[model samples]
Target: MPRLPRADRAADAALLAGLTVADPQAAAAFVRRFQGAVYGLALSITRDPGLAEDVSQEAFVKAWRAASTYDVRRASVLTWLLTITRNTAIDAVRSRRPVPMGAELLDQLIEDSLRSPDLAESAVHRLETERAIAHLHHLSPDQARAVVLAVIGGCTAAEVSQREHIPLGTAKTRIRDGLRRLRAAYAGGDLEVDHG
Candidate 1:
């Protein structure tokens, strides 16, 4: 008998169900399906490769441990998984910071900021995203990659430096210069203007 191809949702749901049952195969499949996405999110938030790896692992472990409690009604498995990953990344970041007053409120604010925007706001956000993507072409290749990694990829200058095999200062300069050029272009100023 030929096996049926599962829809993405169906595949995720089946994997999640397997998770609840402590099925090793399901766990492997689930992790395989979302590792890149989870890691990307963690990397973006932590901006540190080592910390992102830890957070990604912890996020997957937490999801596995609480698999039975997952509510498909509330969110798709991928959405739920990413939310856990994001929260875990946020917590990891906060823990490394010097504790100040209102930490709890800050955490809450960050979580709130991550929530989905409504239709009106999403439309504006989409246009802004489009504009940003368009502006990337005006930057030099290295500068554009650094800017995109730091901004869209959620990487720190250090991460960009490491990834690009360049010195940290060079990475920072590229990102700064790229951003300034982008800002100038958007503001209708001369693109070739250099303050240095």
Candidate 2:
């Protein structure tokens, strides 16, 4: 999306200033101008349409609440909106935990794979795995760790719960939510993969 021009910036600043003095229309216009960019950024980071929508709404609400603190000297309105989106997404990711997997099952799979060829195909697989890991990091630390354990560690929901010290249901939900976000991020072109 094109950045708002300087002239528009001045107008927006003026509108925001008016809003501080109780101009409802100016506040409405401010929301109309920046809501799309905020939602887009949230969607890019969270990867769930519903979650993105909620985050977008929350971000705007935050902007409205914090409008008095907005200093045009520090950054553009869009920049401030995006910062709120990013922080909101990160917060959403952190509060949730991941489901656990069976340690014995994972060990069995590893043992079973020991006889498989560790050749060019394995190298390619490793590279793809690394790319997935990189994408996973875009999530909040809790989500990322849960996703890594579920995808890479091959842990079951119960196992993840035990390891993370969270309830089984919470673990499961986090793993499911993380996977959903991962798929959304990959499909939305927010994440790049190295096929080779």
Candidate 3:
């Protein structure tokens, strides 16, 4: 391991001592020693001089507040300060991102999703579909058959009724029960279903 310079170690010791006691002189000295590198790291991350300055200031304020938590065993003073600057700069960039969608947008998204079968074939939705299919194993065979026919096979309840040679009500009941059971498997937890 490369050794820290003796003079740098001595300066670190003095700066740490000052920061630990919230000494203004020590804080100033610490800033004077480390400001260039901190600002540079923040600027590189934020890509804006003004934002870099803000991030640097926030990083310094955070460092000052969290000074007592600093441990030389964990990192050198410069390493810790740069970490703070990088994180603060990242947060500044994130803060400038577009605002989150509202509840109306969420509802519209859900409605669009329901009308789009191809959307359900996307990779993420395919994984969710596989998970839902796995959960179908927890259902009774008759119920599972009803759900597969109605949901996967895209059959109406009457078609399921005709195909399964069961009454319309029986087909509907099987689909509803299967759906409710799967819903429970997701929303609740494991259930003891004795199909005997």
TM-score per candidate, chains pooled: 0.49, 0.45, 0.45
Better of 2 and 3 by lDDT: 3
lDDT of 1 by residue, 1-196 (tens): 6663342334788898888888777788788778887897788677799999999999999998888898776556776787788789877876886642143443343333333333443343344435555566566767877776665444678867877799999999999998889768766665653333
The whole-model lDDT of each prediction reads: 0.71, 0.63, 0.68
lDDT of 3 by residue, 1-196 (tens): 8985443445665686678788777787788777877886676566689999999999999998888888776556776777677678766765775543333433343343233334424443344445555677667767877776665344578867877799999999999988777667765567456272
> How do these models rank on lDDT, best leading?
1, 3, 2
Model 2 bad stretches (over 4 Å): 1-10, 97-196
Expressed as tens digits, the lDDT of each residue in 123-194 for candidate 2 is 434443345555666666666656656554545677677777899988898889777777776555574332
Q: After superposition, how far is residue 175 of candidate 3 from its true place, in Å?
A: 42
Tell me which of candidates 1 and 2 scores higher on lDDT.
1
Clashing pairs in 3: none
lDDT of 1 at 93: 78
TM-score result, candidate 1 = 0.49
**Which candidate has the top score in TM-score?**
1
